[model samples]
Target: MSDYQPKILSGGEHRSDDEIMADYGVSEDSPLVIMELLQRFHVKDIMRSRNIISLTRENTLREAKELMRDNKISGLPILEGKRLFGMVSMNQIIKALEGGWLDDPCQQHMSTSLVVLEEDIPVSIALKYFHNYTFGRFPVLNKEHEFVGILSQRDITSALLKELTSEISKLEGKTEAAVVEQRPVENVKSEWVIPYYSLRQFVIVRNDLANAGKAANEIKRMLKEAGVNSKIVRKVAVAAYELEINVCIHSLGGSLTIVLDTHKVTIIAKDNGPGIKDVDWACQDGTSTANDWIRSMGFGAGMGLSNCKRVADTFNIKSVVPTGTTVICEFNLSA
Candidate 1:
């Protein structure tokens, strides 16, 4: 056996909730429509499940380096009979070459402090991880803890960009006059609306992309069922979706509460920790701390907060650094 000590999470830090959220928070640049797309897809939808290049613990570091070079990948997971033991990154290869241990087994120097994504998580949450961490790729696992695939920023970006382009094309196909006519309905308020009431809460899991916009979709569906105006439903749905995504992407974990009364619909998204540093800055459109990878995936555009604010008749946000963030968006039902 090689004498090298395995390094913990050499690819990225095991960050605290506050640290992670503070590094990157809500943004307002990407179209709110893309928010739906982000929620529509999951990691399994875009992850590279086939032809995944991986290695065994007993594989030599020299072989790992050669595979990385040939494949132009920066990292490889070290497996022990389908179990993820650790990862071997390019940094480890350099150190091995320098230390004259290139022939050693991968288990001797692989990074064990790993960051992984669930196969079922929404692509939106995965995009956030790519923004927050420096790792070029993350190993994906199923609920059974079985390694299923590999998720790369490039693959996600390519897939989302294609969808975004297609969506944009559809939007552009509509005439300006048609769009202008639709705006009034979105802004309209009616005193003649039927009374509707409900209260519900949804658990928002940290990095749980698999169920990212479920709350919003549920809220939208419920409101429509309750006979709410289409315009009011759209606004409430947009707000709920943005906040829900924020909690999923930024918070350690939290809950989304939706209150529907006769007069208005209120959505409150509150998270546990990893809060924002500057609430004012975070609310600004096109202001985001998301890294290049996230931007490439059409997220971290700094429009999440702004998107919510733009549609809500009442909007309020309160945050404490390293603690958490709470945002409320209310849409008046009565004009």
Candidate 2:
């Protein structure tokens, strides 16, 4: 009567994780046999030989679709001369078919944008890039943006599993590094008023949402070192980032004010861009003017205003079309 259920997941060693299965159950010869099989076989060990199917900007969408069907390919790497430009696939073409009428250049239906990575870059880096864009494949590039080859989801997943197998072997040998114990989040009480020395006009022109988050984290670290606690810092971060993304997605750009005092915290964002035409509609969930690029990054969920409202005690948005928008939020520490 072991207290553990086999299907139940425990943090460390569940009833049957790799370590538990390897150390307690697997035959010594089994691991070696598996390793040999992986080395002798598996796509990860070999240079990928998948034929590179591609399209040009000038090609008609019909031609691209025909190539995909005739060749039994799911994706295509788009190119201009020898330079890797973007990528398109059957999925996007289907989406276009369902969403709108399509009779134009491949560039119109095609995703003429991509975030390429170096050929030698780690698969982990490629995976992160994949998270930001819903593309089936990517053109591998050299330093000069020259098309070297391409990477696919199939290759990336195989590499991940291969690395995983090595780790399983390490755990079998009892040579795994000791992991640091994690403390509970409740163990930490959020602090207020993170004092800062170099706090000035932080004009963060964030093109990427991830960069916006990073800038906020750096500011939090600065404030924490100055004696601010985690709670107040997170409020500032949420308010600051929502406003920042509002600028990145909808506005030109904006500056933030990180003013800290004994009683309150204020964050202000001002940007020049397409001001919200209808505040009531824009504030509704799932309402957004974000393009595919912005939507892919997990923004434009129409949650920005709601998020700000939840975190900031006072939230305000004022805008004029063809002019600019201003979002002001404040948190009261005294409460």
Candidate 3:
């Protein structure tokens, strides 16, 4: 039987939908099934408790700004006796200042067209709200529409990451058990079969600054849990993070995969791109194609690929003019 599989690169070259399904042992109908299961996760499952910081309609813009600064938060829910009145954010503060209302009450400057979330609603619903609006946080209400807590993008990400980690761990356990049970005793004794296992996960890398390095962080966590050497894990983490950030800052968007085996860890990052015009120059230090916006965020210092190569045991890159770019980095476990 041939090991060749079809490659689909509509957006990127990481993996096709079919490839993802095969990797996870899911059928064609599995997407709907998975979404149905995901819908069972309630907002409360991921939301912070009711001890959240909030503002009041009676509070002045100055006070609200001070509260936001003190809490290191971007927004706050405005409440009156446990009832949500409005939402106040830095945008509101700036608007108030422009209108000479810095000392005025929050209600006068707050946004009243609230988009509140229910505690018992599916987290999928909250995800839609997040995709549709630019709000940093949404006020959460209970059955009586009373203020409870707030849900932010960070909260949802943390919850989903935990769920994914748990699922992957369970899958790895099952795979290891199956391998042990199926291998012949003679083969195990001789170590001819290598007794090796592999795991692959696909991660989406967006060009958003707020979400950069998230995939690499999760990969590091998984490697640590899998008993990889701390020194090797750190090196892999540095390379993975640099490559991940490179995809975010330079490419339009991309997919990254971390493949783990008994002896090696491989990271493959593929991006929809205006491919590199000069690979040699790109590999050199202080060579950058990033824009001013990315630089202002303390990124795009022209060191991503070079730094990644420095930490990786082996590295290779391929690119096409208008098609895309792919980078493969490998780290040896037994080294």
Specify the highest-lDDT model's number: 1
Candidate 1: what lDDT?
0.76
In the range 1-335, model 1's lDDT, one tens digit per residue, is 33322232222436653455344442444344555566668889888755678899889999999999999888998876556778999899999999999999998899987888888887767766886777888888777777777899888878888987775564454334333432323333432233445566777765545557887997899788888899999999998988887887667677788777778789999988889998999999998876444455556789999999999999999999788999988899884
In terms of lDDT, the poorest run of 10 residues in model 3 is 1-10
lDDT tens readout by residue for model 3, 81-199: 77777788889888887888899988777877777777887775666666555677778888777888889878887887787666456446644654553343442343222346444
TM-score of each: 0.47, 0.41, 0.45
Q: How do these models rank on lDDT, best leading? A: 1, 3, 2
Evaluate model 3: give its TM-score: 0.45
In model 3, the runs with Cα more than 4 Å from the true position are 1-37, 182-335
Clashing residue pairs in candidate 2 are 190-231, 191-229, 191-230, 194-228
Q: Find the candidate with the highest TM-score and give its number.
A: 1
Task: Please say which candidate is ahead in TM-score: 2 or 3.
Answer: 3
Top-down TM-score ranking: 1, 3, 2
